[model samples]
Target: AQSVAQPEDQVNVAEGNPLTVKCTYSVSGNPYLFWYVQYPNRGLQFLLKYITGDNLIKGSYGFEAEFNKSQTSFHLKKPSALVSDSALYFCAVRDLTDKLIFGTGTRLQVFP
Candidate 1:
């Protein structure tokens, strides 16, 4: 079975401050990790993905993530946050079946 858990229901961050949204996963095999952002009434937008290779992967809007195999975690980070960055975030894992299992969803509120 594959699953993801985002412990936090919401993360409060300030503009220009570094922000992180924690995520953990359990999968049967090597997982394909992905981060997606969603604004109100909009579909999710791909931020980044970690298929294979580097432990540190960078993505859109100056966001990046680190894959820790031992811990089975993939945490999203940003050196500087923005008010516009405030939105809903979802961490997902794709197994051999190529089906994405998403977290409950985390809301990031970035205050300016």
Candidate 2:
């Protein structure tokens, strides 16, 4: 079975500092990993994806993630944070049917 787990329910960060949100997955085949963000009253917006090659992948809004095959982890990171970056973050895995199974959703509160 394929699944993605985000153990944290929330993460707090001050503006202009580095930030990260943890993610890990299990899949039967090569996984297609994805990150997305949601603002109040809005649907999720795609941040990035890792299909193949390059364990380290960069994404939108100055975010990036390292895909670790051995550890079965894909942790998101950002060099510096912004207050506007505050939102609900989700880590998902592409299922066999091309559907996404999302985490419960992590609330990222970026204090100014």
Candidate 3:
């Protein structure tokens, strides 16, 4: 079974500083990793994904992730943080059955 883990329960960053949400995945074959962000009382919003090709993939809201095969990790990153960016972030990977397996999720808090 494919699984994803978010080692951090929460990440704190000042508004205007860079922020990162860690994610590591375990899969049988080629990994299909994804990142999503959920605001308060909102559904998960698509952030980015790594299917193949480029190691670095950019997504909505100035977010990007690097696919590191050697490390088996795909960490989400943003150059600058914002108070509005405070939300719950999730890391996921596709299972052999083509279903998404998500991590426990990491809450991001950006302080001013």
The prediction achieving the highest TM-score against the true structure is 3
Taking all chains together, each candidate's TM-score versus the true structure is 0.97, 0.96, 0.98
For model 3, how does the per-residue alpha-carbon lDDT over 11-82 read when each residue is reduced to its tens digit? 999999999899999999999999999999999998998999999999999999988999999999999999
The 10 consecutive residues of candidate 3 with the worst lDDT sum are 92-101
- Misplaced by over 4 Å in model 3 are none
**Reference-based lDDT, residue 112, model 3:** 99
User: Candidate 2 on 28-70: residue-level lDDT in tens?
Assistant: 9899999999999999999999999999999999999999999
lDDT of 1 by residue, 22-112 (tens): 9999988788999999999999999999989999999999999999999999999999999999999999998667789999999999999
Give the better candidate number (1 or 2) by lDDT: 1
Cα TM-score of candidate 1: 0.97
lDDT (C-alpha, whole model) for all candidates: 0.95, 0.93, 0.95
Candidate 1 segments exceeding 4 Å error: none
Cand. 1 Cα-lDDT: 0.95
